[model samples]
Target: MSNTIYKNGIFGPNEWAVLEDEADLPESGKVLVSPDRFLALEGSAPEGVELGVVIRAGEKAERLVAHLAKLPMVAIDFPKFSDGRGYSSARLLREKFGYKGELRAIGDVLIDQIPFMIRCGIGSFEISHAPTRRALEEDRLNEVPIYLQPVGRDGEVPLGTRPWARRRVA
Candidate 1:
């Protein structure tokens, strides 16, 4: 059961669909794939597929770095919200691999994690939980505006670090 995606802080529609590792790949639009499923594809796999890869817990980001430019999205699997490995994956994909595309948090995506996930470079989330979906729909998520540690594309300077955090002003 897929719910509306929380994209760019807006509760909006989710056009993408998640498929099993062994399922047949779609020919177009947004499709998220598991790492092993992605690797199993032939080098001659269909082009312009608008692919999004999902990183399971414990999966290394380095293996996906080379494919970053080719993929429009990369989703980190949370499996359980308590597992914070997705945060590391987001940071690596953004900070290290320089992936400017959409970084998504999949699986057990909860409302409370959205703000933190954004800090780690996750641009969107795949929410399936009813309470979570309701929370996002009611605009009850992403309330934190001030942050202590700076990360991701949002250039807000960390808390108490600068008077003019908006920009360099030079």
Candidate 2:
């Protein structure tokens, strides 16, 4: 329900100022991060200021997984939908990084990408414009049912050995 620009836990538009932009930033207990500026930190980011990071196309996704795991939330920036690097980054964050945090998408997000984005690990999405009819349909994506079956041999086992790996050995 919230509509705002974010990175890690910081918020900004095209340009942000350390002192002048206090009004746009969330309160001490809220989180805001800039995907573009996430490479660095600011004056400790209040108390509950969330942080966001931007992943570029073809960049090494593994390098940031460990760093992202430590944070409570992360937002991957998508410069444009045509650029698919963010998709792989999101998948790696969920499958490889084991990041159990709020994974959001910001910048150039549209309706068609919602379902795939959610599967990849983006729980929240920020569309630069007000939700268009197409965008609303994208929100309906939340209603779609997922059909994939239990992936591992625990069949539905809670967690023993990874099913695929065990099958490979068998």
Candidate 3:
């Protein structure tokens, strides 16, 4: 019943602990905090504790713009498969704000949407779906090789002179 954390092209353990609003911060560990808590803490957690923010649905990623440089990780909640706002948030964080740290997606992460998520700059995923977990564990995900829109990530080649049509180089 453990959740699988897929990162850097491999499925492994989740190292960061998610903290509730009322929970006491650990003295030394990686912790994911809500936006309000993150703001309240002002990006300052206990010594030896790495701070990360979980940007939930309906929350704007811009709120974290000032603190992006200090954050080692940022997890965007999917909440549901149909909610695509996290994609835009990821893109903005990577492309606009230039957040080079680990961008993670949590909840409702499906195999079909993983490729697209990667394109949007999500480097890790906290996956709970059994089928998706199996796909990652087996290294057999169904994905489209070609992409029409450019996401500004490396290894994406333009298909032709159109400038919009592109394909992933991998």
Candidate 4:
């Protein structure tokens, strides 16, 4: 992915390095490890490296609850555009677990799903899709103004008198 990340409404170099399961850990840097690796190194990761975890679609979000505070970033894998499990994982990490760190969506991220992903509390995206990346870069996403579901996020106002219908604050 060339260390390029779209985050906080800007495209910038990604500071976190993703580590392969068989790779050796670097002494100093921000690193994102797989769920299993994260669990194994939970209390014993190298002190110089800031740790993060990438949760796959099938992994349980609760597995990282106790370590949320120490984690600066948590990435949920979409795997495919049809897989909606990452959305729920992001919501659980943000709302239920009270995770205030960066929630990143990785793998199979598409332009059409950006707005919905934001509503679900995913703040960053690691996009590999060429069209999606182009849309993001050009700021030409066709976003829906109204939301049919209440995601319990701040700055969302109810549309008319219907509590279920909401719009994001500009």
Write the residue-wise lDDT of candidate 2 on 6-60 in tens digits: 3333333422112222235555443444433444554456565655454556656
lDDT for position 95 in model 1: 88
How would you encode candidate 3's per-residue C-alpha lDDT over 1-170 as one tens digit per residue? 25489887787889998898999999998999998899999746777888899999989999989989888999999999999999999999998999989999998999999989987889899988898888888988766776766655568774343544555677
Better of 1 and 3 by lDDT: 3
How does residue 103 of candidate 2 score in lDDT? Answer: 74
For each candidate, give its TM-score against the true structure.
0.78, 0.55, 0.87, 0.87
Q: Mark the regions of model 1 whose C-alpha exceeds 4 Å error after superposition.
A: 1-3, 27-29, 145-170
Per-residue lDDT of candidate 1, residues 62-94 (tens digit) = 997777778777888999989998889888888
lDDT of each: 0.76, 0.56, 0.86, 0.85
Off by over 4 Å in 3: 1-3, 152-154, 157-165
TM-score of 3: 0.87
lDDT of 4: 0.85
Per-candidate alpha-carbon RMSD to the true structure: 4.2, 8.5, 2.5, 2.5
Better of 1 and 4 by lDDT: 4
Give per-residue CA lDDT, model 4, range 71-167, as digits (tens): 8999888999999999999989988999999999888999999988987889888877888888888987777787777655567774344654566
Error of model 2, residue 84, in angstroms: 1.0
Over the full model, what C-alpha lDDT does candidate 2 score relative to the true structure? 0.56
**Which numbered prediction scores highest in lDDT against the true structure?**
3
Clashes in each model (backbone N, CA, C under 3 Å)?
0, 19, 0, 0
